[model samples]
Target: MTLTIEELRAGVPKHSRKMITQNVVEVLNQLSSDHGEDFAEHYKQNLMSMSTVLKSGTYNMKDYMNAVKFSAFRLMDHSDVDSYMLAFPERYQRLMLKYADYGDEQSIRADKISSFVTAYKKNEIVAKVTEQALIPSRILNAPMFQTALNIQMSIAMSSRSDQVRSQAAESVMKYTMSPEVQKIELEVGVKGQDEIMALRTEMHRLASQQQGTIMSGTNTSLEIAEQVILHEIEDHDDIDISGELG
Candidate 1:
């Protein structure tokens, strides 16, 4: 049985995803050569929007044709991005820059750990971090410390968060994100407990539902591949347009 990240990952085996990605790229370039660079770029960009890989967020297989998946996969296996960078820097420049930006963002996140800093002052970072956390905890006034933790999870390097914060985030994620876990809120009186429990359940359920709804909109990378490949074959007929194009 293949370890699954999400539903769309079912058809493709885990190991071959990269080779498929490289094939996709090769086909993309070939299409470009056959058609015109203009057509190629438009085709690639359309696929890219489908492949949309965000620099922030927990590494999940959400987007289509996202090279970031390969980048993350490569890093997890080798614990380094150097080989990936050197092997196909131009082809995977987005992932390279993304990995690089992760480091840069980590530095920024680490520096803003001070209590004096406000999430409002750093809105972009805070927003990205919150989205990455995948926790829709309501905050009438989100304090710096909480948002700081969110930021750490969003873009910080694995080592950036000390053991305590790491454990806290892990615990939160483990309980909050798990389907088996009861998301009841702890309260004092029986009435309060019941109300809070109901509310927490609703919120947690809604968050999960919202997440599922979002994921459903995602088109598989192969969808893009099919459209591009078909356009290339039917429209260009493998004819070289490198001269007229460039």
Candidate 2:
């Protein structure tokens, strides 16, 4: 039932109001099937309209800009986003080749990262990661864990680790220290950062003595698809009580 303003506007032209309502009903049913009744009700209550008050050009940049500003604000002032690309050049190159249809680089990068993070926040990421766990090769090879690997490598080798950590700690020292954990916290404001930081610290503290191989490279298309499958499976389980498995 929920959609972006642009999506809502697009749907309005293609479908009638009643059709929309029915469609929303079906969607809510499906959501309920996956997320439980409580979540379904919550989502229905929060269903949003796509209409917006625009100032001149179309396509409201409010939310998009907010995300960008948030990322920029939390990120090191002089930190190079390109560094991620440099560290994992092949992954970026492959993405450029695969996503050629999307001409905007920044848009592509933002979409890619946001999609991953959003799914992670929704608990979809865990399913996906678990699914990856199912893939025997990924668990054994390590390279299959591209996104996580990249983040791990970036943090392990970051020149601004101390600087980044200091700023991040100021924003959230009580949480944890893992980048994956910290990145999400930065989105929810300062307090969230602390919580994530504390989580990160705990993660490392527990793993400190363990010398397991860490994923340390960029993500690949196959890896992305794998994660998506995992997300779907997790979502499927979350909404369907009968679908739960051991």
Candidate 3:
């Protein structure tokens, strides 16, 4: 049976889900284009099975590579193997010699087949497939995320209870609205008498500077009043004037 991308993504961790799912989809598309749809379908099934095992977090990279290699081998026909060996005779001969230590003919043949499959995985196309198969899927997609907002909208439009409808509408609005940018205000206070006195002296100097500007008609009375009030608020112990205006 064919597994959807959504189903495949269910087995993946949230952090890597999107990246892995996208890569898997691309690899599957490439497979379908290179081979037939039937071959790609079988490969996808194998990938799904591997993904299921992956959810347990028990499988290692070697197990994953072997799984993909065997999956491709299972789909290979005699003609396919013959074509591969013809294409890479030296590699196949090397693999056969590598497995010659096995005692019986059947044992040697089985070992040769296993080694051949492993070596086959190094081919460019097969390497791409194996790399993608190792990654898990995504947890959420755009459609699924939008579903919650859609439900809220429906409730807001058609609910029987007016209060419930209002609440739902408010919720929908809350979700749809762009978040307000928060403004942070930090206030540093002077608790020591020495620090307070130093601040008072600075405020007096600033006020004197402003007085000359006021006399010269460069500064307004209201501006001077605001500056004095701000300084007074800073000097006071019980008052807090550090916050956003709105």
User: Candidate 1 lDDT, tens digit per residue, 1-246?
Assistant: 111223222334444344344445565566455546764554443333222123333333323333432232233353223323332346445543445644664453344322112322244433332232222222222244334433433321123223333344354345445444322222222324454344434434433443444458654433322222111111112221111000
Instruction: Please give the CA lDDT of all the candidate structures.
Output: 0.35, 0.35, 0.49
User: Could you give candidate 2's per-residue lDDT for residues 173-231 as a string of tens digits?
Assistant: 23223444211111122234454344455435423212121123344323322331111
- What would the per-residue lDDT of candidate 3 be over residues 87-170, giving only the tens digit for each residue? 345766776677677665457545555456556657544554444443322112323434565466555444555455446656
Better of 2 and 3 by TM-score: 3
User: How does model 3 score by TM-score?
Assistant: 0.28
Cα RMSD for candidates in order:
26.1, 21.5, 24.1
Note the residue pairs that clash in candidate 1.
none
Off by over 4 Å in 3: 1-21, 58-66, 75-246
Give each model a TM-score. Answer: 0.19, 0.19, 0.28
Candidate 1 lDDT at 94 equals 57
Q: Number of the top candidate by TM-score?
A: 3
